[model samples]
Target chain A: MTQVSTTISKEKCFEQLLLGKTVKRVPGQYLSGSEGWLEAVRAEALENARALNFPSDRHDDWRFTDLSPLFQHGFQPVSSFAKLTPGDIEKFLIPGSTRLVFVDGCYDAGLSELGFSGSAGAHGVTVSSLVERIGDVQVETYFARQASFKQDAFAALNTRFFEDGAFVHVTGEAAAPIHILHVATRREAPSAIYPRCLVVMEPDSRATVVEDYAGLEDGVNFSDAVTEVVLKDDAQLQHVRVQRDEKNAFHIGHCSVAVGRGSVYAATSLAFGARVSRHDLHAVQMGEGAEIRLNGLALITGRQIADTHTRIDHAFPRGKSVQLHKCIADGAAHAIFNGKVIVHPGAAGTDSSQSSRNLLLSGKARIDTQPQLEIFNDDVKCKHGATVGQIDADSLFFLRSRGFSEERARNLLSHAFAAEIIIKIPVPSLVESLSRTILDRMSGVRT
Target chain B: MINKDSRVLLEVRNLRAEVVVDGVRGVEILKGVDLTVRAGEVHAIMGVNGSGKSTFSKVLAGHPEYTVTGGTATFEGRDLLALAAEERARAGLFLAFQYPVEIPGVSNSALLRLAYNTLQNERGLEELDPLEFEDLVLEKIKVVEMDASFLDRSVNEGFSGGEKKRNEILQMAVLEPRLAILDETDSGLDIDALRIVANGVNSLLTADNAVVMVTHYQRLLNYIVPDYVHVMDGGRIVRTGGKELALELEARGYDWVRAAA
Candidate 1:
């Protein structure tokens, strides 16, 4: 028996890069010249492993939940690819937006259509593949100067291995909205798709972007995605992400948003599937009078598991942020919520509040919620609270006594619990559709 | 004595119940009670606080906590003891609760829809969808003079004492039960609310239905006159008379009845 070790030198890295370069001239893109990004990812993965093996005993963050089920199975990188046609793209397209299709982690130009008018002129908007813009000097420079990657392991992995994603740029005076619909279809066997989205809004610009992750069939798959957004002075952006995958899938997504002076940023995440899923959202208010609003909704049943971890950082004076996350868990499913708000020194006049509420329908269902606040400045107003409880018994009995059957009573209570947040959505039809879907998932328990 | 040919709507025979306290059963509340009500007539039962007036009402509606040791109540010649509380409601037996329960997050309109559908189902009839039910409920809301806005609010949540009682009468009006039992419906109401509730009850009276008014005061009787007034004492009807009995009881309190007993 013998053992062999393989080592790669710096020259090997350059050779591999040159062999993979296909574009003649790199368009303006992010994360092309960052050497530290790849190194940071490797370190974060080791840290995550250590945290899993030996958790901190000082806090009760993970007291109610057991993480052994997630680490039971080992996952592999995706290799097999699925080819998608234009008709397939049309079948899965969202009603109101331009489509950007990615098959097996590779961008397909023939399957994607961008730009409202199909014009090449610069009208304060640009949409293209990351591979075409990776070599641009400006994109490389911006990637180097922004974001800290050592805290999150999945973001590091996406930064290191994501081949091609979507790059959106809005000019200073742009007014129209740009919607980026990212569709990921699973292939045979255990596969993975890394969707990286970079959105930049110049000064005085306004836009909205949506990222959607879905599976085509029932299979063991993984979706590792990261989205970075930069809003310049007085700019506004509304970002929404939806993750709906098969029961055998694993999804890890991260969203990092940066806001400048007097800018407004709002982001929402809706998770309804995947056997194991984790979402990390970080928003930073860098200048005075910047505001951020983050809302999240998750529905879990069966043996599914979903964790949402979010943080909002206030670095300047008079910055405000509010975060609300709600979860409904039934059967043997488990849900986790961890949200933190940090107010740094000199960040006075900051008003921030965060609340996480969970509704457990079954005795076997479990939820762990941790809402934290770290403030250094005394003048700031910050509050955080978390609550986990079963549905009110009095309410159930009242409904039942009113001629609603037992099943109908439970269904109405569940709908009313989840609808408190769903009704906040601006679109009426979308809210109704989501409400109906939630009710259907709940019907099994009532029956 | 109940008239045999008067078309009996509800008949209770030998109804015995008890109040369980601290793992030990206390004195019997309703001890071998017998009563009968005829359709198209209004009956009033006036009693003191401990006379088991409310207990009899709750027992008939099949509240789970109250134990029925030996009893049988038949509604329209059907076994009422075999039915659950909700089943009893669907079988045309309405009990206006003494303390109407507050149901948070459930709108009044939605609760009415469920009640309407359950009644329809028990009758083997087709159920109305939301659009049609809304139209039907809006027409019935006027019977109680309820504001249309109340339909959007949660059931009895933040409602005043008078409003909750009025809400109960409103439900009874919409349900249109064959036997309507008002258990202290005038407990917390002012003069105005009592008049409105009494008017709503009067509007629902018909030859095919009956009303059982349980009260301790004669004020409510001044508005909705009763055909028969029974004085209940120690879980039994000690005296029975025409509508003048209520006036006599008002003039001379329960002391005269207790002295006679």
Candidate 2:
């Protein structure tokens, strides 16, 4: 057993659960209606899970963020949705919108529209729990395509334990985005949750998927999430994830996407909570003429830490990608960003640009960023840059001279620095909501 | 708006100040400087380079780097030095900075709205909506013949020197303060831009308000004539006279004033 952060031993944590030589599907899941091929796939996933290893600091991908704290707690899979009554999920819910709600790691049939009769069926969208939809036609093939448990150990861990998550298949175009809320309910024993989401868009279709994670602010919890997205030819998808987890919570989530030929994938991930969290976004342009935009913001304060690592690979010619991620850390906080764009050997005429900017509002606050471009094709145009600094002194004084208080001036300039990326979100209410969150976090923050 | 006994818009008495370096040592800039300006007047303080003219304007705005060792500044009989910089600005004192800052992401319209709304809140007046504010800002933008798109761009970012000066006047127009201190507002402006800025200042001048122009040249006086011109040397206002003093100081350089003093 590997012993780290807390007094609890690794045996007292995930050793017996995730590190087992041979893993089974979570003890009690709703997998009754599965057939031969789907059952065979599940058994194969379990075999793959058994061969996986936990990520450690020694690994290049996990070097910056430490998961020792996560390995110090004993967690159980939330077998059913009967753990807690659905009470606070309404506050996080967008009014009059179709959504799927998960408690701990299980989907609450009472709280989710997927369980209702013809709820989202008439809207040209299919919504269901992956447990029940494993044998269905649209979802059976797209489950493990993008986020390969065979490669990512954490994803392998989630695939072994995750029971219920949102399964959304959008036809033509969704009338309204399907919102997925993964709410965590803590117990006496420290709990770990693996939230999963699979969004598959049909050819020539368009849709949006919002994955929001919420939990008690002071609770001891852990969530490692995996979301796999597939955009078929000429399909467009806008995926937004809001992470406002518990303060003592440890969250490490990854979103893997495969952009089809001439398809567009736009994503924005806002990280505003957790003790230590890092979001990984890996997008691969699998076909020609694909376009992708990945933008994110992480706000950290106190002793908190947030980091984001993004990689966009141009595999075919005429692929385009734009990446911008920002981090604002105050107090004794730490924020890190590493964004890389790769142009393959034959992927000529590929245009890519990536920028990673950070704002340090306190002397003790730190930021580390590396924006890299690795291009093999000479004809491709690729650019990457990184910057880290404090607010402009002259701008602050200028605002103050115009009748803004010192605090107000700093907040306005800080907000402007963040809005350079936050305003790009297409949802109006979500933009306003996230703006208020950023402002509230920015209140009383100074350099 | 000037009536009998309109008001004493600004009065400075025996102002002594210095720039505190590293928060310890002090370099004396304004030594025993005394000045006064009433409503319905434009006072031009002419000085050679490094005569502490800019320091005096900044000190009035409560710049933190400047320390007022001994002095009292009054605006409408209220002690200005006792208030914070924003409070001083709210009390109708506006300083047109010599070097306007270029804030990359903040738009000009947003900056003007915040300043205008804050002033309205200070004075207990009704704030205008966005459309009304746009109309008001547009009306003021014409004073400098500024392009309408200037309001849409980031504040002062990438603006040419002439455009920056005109932007300062445009801000003065949007925020109609009682005392508008133009610190080198004429510097770096072309002849055409100088005329537009001078004309904007002339159009905004009211008998109930005042203007203070700190300049090194007499050319600006040719456009917006000053009622009084004060010569500053060795951190003191050694001489004061009518607008003719500006021409005299121009024809006969500031060396004559220092030699006579």
Indicate which candidate wins on DockQ.
2
List of clashing residue pairs for candidate 2: none
- Each model's C-alpha lDDT? 0.73, 0.82
- List, residue by residue over B94-141, the lDDT tens digit for candidate 2: 899899988766788988988898899899999887788999998999
Restricting to chain A, the TM-score for each candidate equals 0.80, 0.90
Score every model by TM-score.
Answer: 0.76, 0.85
**Model 2 lDDT tens row, A135-179:** 667676877666777877667777666666788887777767678
Q: How well does model 2 score by local distance difference test?
A: 0.82
Residues A1-447 of candidate 1: C-alpha lDDT, one tens digit per residue: 121213333333223322222222223423353555544543454454333332222335444434334333333344434566667655446455555666656676666667541332266666677656655443454542343345444554555557677777766443343445555554443444567888777888777666777766666656778888888899988777777777877787878888999999987788888888878788999799899988887788888888888889999999999888888898888998888899999788999988898889888888878888999999988887888877665555445555666677777777776766665554454555666667677673221
TM-score of chain B of each: 0.95, 0.97
C-alpha RMSD between model 1 and the true structure:
6.9
